[model samples]
Target chain A: MSGTRGERFHVGTRKGIFTVAKVGGAWQVVEAGHVGDNVPIVMHDPRDDTLYAALDHGHFGGKLHRRPAGGGDWEEIGVPTYPDLPEGVEEDTDASGRVIPWTLKLVWSLVPGLDDQPGRLWCGTLPGGLFRSDDRGDTWELVRGLWDHPDRKEWMGGGADWPGVHSIAVHPTDGDRLTVGVSCGGIWVTEDGGASWACRADGMRAEFMPPDRAGDPRIQDPHCLVQCVGAPDRFWVQHHNAIYRSVDDCASWQEVEGEPTHFGFAVSVHPEDPETAWFVPAIKDEHRVPQDAHLVVSRTRDGGETFDVLRNGLPQEHAYDLVLRHAMDLHGDGRCLAFGSTTGNVFVSEDQGDSWTCVSTHLPPVYCVRWEGRASAG
Target chain B: MPRVAFTPNLQRHVACPPRDVEGATVREALDAVFAGNPKARGYVLEDDGALRKHMNVFVDGRPVRDRVTLGDAVSPGGEIYVMQALSGG
Candidate 1:
């Protein structure tokens, strides 16, 4: 942290959100808020230096909190609530035939609005609902097009009892265009700012389902999706069964050829380089721990043409931790990449995934990690 | 008035100090408490206004029969308890 001018890393864990900033030459916990609440995601709005934390209360429900940039007490912002079910539409049913009601179980992902829309924000929630907020986190409206899509009936759950929109990517150049990744429903794209949505899982595969339905778009599962900011057309998806790269803005996807293991929960892409990406590969869906109990990060500098395992500082054996879908992140020009594990370990690689250093080992099971950097004013 | 109390576990995420609220039914008693802290209402009840699956309500050491509408009548000086169900990994 010697050259840290304004670098902050927030780790969202099962117990709370931990704020660590570079003090002197090492990362130190400047503040640890939400002491006993489960923080699924902590996002920093770079436009205004505001931080939003999605707190998941097991007994209760999900709650959203925000704080200013420099750090202070968090103010509770109300969580998103779904509107009444459309007339004549029945409640969703699970595999067991139990009717599932619309509830905000968790705020899985939060993305800042386009550059031109100052106060706009987007949120993805469990139970497969996407919401938009025009006034920051104050008031939210559900994206009804996706909610009422015909494919929703076929959508199933991968990790939860119902499908959830866990990844949302707003195009850097086209504010109206965006993509959303669903756990069991696959990839969806809306070019008209959520007025309409279409499934983009044509080439993605879902091997976990029955053979007849494995290739269906609604049954595809994308664990994580990342878009290269420098090349908005290029995107990478860590699918439930394979790794896919799409060059046509998710119109069609092709499996990345050189992955050691085809399964992982997290994917990180270089901020400025569409060709460079990172993935923490684990065992198959049945066993999610690191492959062979060895924790290694696979880096592909040539856009998935080939991959090199980076494990200079990571555990080589008996490491049973798995990184959640949002537990890994890349910041700035991709000079820094950080990831956290369910075993309560956090690691950072400042040199673009060539090596790593342990940031913390005693945190509660980490759910997500994010990086915020402030440039030095000359 | 009924003596309404929230378990210590629920207090971790919300501030719910045991207090007396005037109401004839369980829903009325909870509504009186929610009037003071609107945020806590979302945590305890779903958007459809039903008790969350992980939450349980007890009246005088017995579980309430009407969980959906919370229409169970409260006896005079009855004690109500709100606690989280034991679940999850």
Candidate 2:
């Protein structure tokens, strides 16, 4: 094995953002930022060594802040704004008969733009809108073309009371193309930049939907979506009811079954290996706890040909930790992985799920985690 | 002019000093204060120009009846208070 540049990862928690670093040859919580606040989303822009945290003020609404490179004060930046409804337009309703408000409910996903487009950022939010930032986080503009699509009316919320975009993957080389995974709305792909989008989530099943509409792609909820950087055409979606794979650039999807459970909200693919992926499993539907109270990570090294439930160093009895969609992350080379759960626990695996170690506990409920350093030698 | 004061809790995240702003209604008064302290606008209201769901506004000790437009009338020299609705941990 060769040297690895990755050292730290930021964690978004129910009440603060924490930075854990490799100290004395072991991972330790080294710094805390934005304490005493609800931080639901955190991202590390490796391009510039900056950190972005999204704070949710129960009474004040959502806010975004970016710490510029070199570790300076966090700067409050412009958040995504929803333009008012057009004249004579009626409010839209979701499947549960709730009217989708034209407001920023929460900043769900923050992703750095492609390498070619420096200083560019993409923000995915609830109420289903994608915003693009040109000059880093100084300002942002909602991608209006996709917001006005005719098919968006069919989208609805899955676990949330309203629909939201929780996963975003940019093509490594194509700056104009990307895909966003929306809960209960499936995956939407844009080829001409943000000018247009289409729901290419065919073959995903939604048993939660009415029997007649079980196969409707637009209403399927992809809990999380990830693409292999080494193989852009290879994608994985931890759908609401089962695991799904897309090998044709999301043109189609197929179910990939895992044992003990097929329900979960987080999925990570090996950055350089399309055939490798990992998922945190829970009992299906109403029972979201770990199967029989055993916390395990299911991994597939042969493109779902088989799955190994890795439980070493993980809680295996009466554990109820539930990982959120953005809580699990993998290093660029996929040799190092980390996941945090709502139970306020964080664990790391260095040998790619063969073993694990708990790094922190008794913090706040963890919402998201991202690697802040370069990928390890794989 | 009505005296507008924000919850001290809000002051922790934003500098919201009590002030006398000119307005005939709750909306006008808040709009007056937010005009100079623009950063405080989002802390009090949501994107639709309405009081946040968990926020409350009081005019001279009475709850502002309309949270949508904040249309409740305000006296020339009355006291206005913007507070977070009481919540439990």
Provide a comma-separated list of chain B TM-scores, one per candidate.
Answer: 0.94, 0.95
Query: Which ranges in model 1 have alpha carbons more than 4 Å from their true place?
Result: A1-6, A88-90, A94-98, A374-378, B1-89
lDDT at position A116, candidate 1: 91
Model 2 alpha-carbon miss at residue A42, Å: 0.6
- Tens digits of per-residue lDDT for model 1 on A157-259? 6677667889999988787788999877889999999999999888887655433445777668899999888788999999878999988878788998645
lDDT tens digits, residue span A1-378, model 2: 112645678899998998887889898888999999999899888777888999999799999999977789998988888888789878766432347898999899999987689999999998888999989878888898778887777676666656788888888889789899987687999998899899999999876543445588777889899998889999999987799998999999989987668989899998888999999999865557899899999999999879999999999888999998999998875778889999989998888989988998788999999888533233
Fnat of every candidate, listed in order: 0.00, 0.00
**Local distance difference test scores for all models:** 0.81, 0.84
**On a 0 to 1 TM-score scale, where does candidate 2 land against the true structure?**
0.79
Interface RMSD of 2: 16.7
RMSD of 1: 14.5
DockQ, per-model, please? 0.01, 0.01
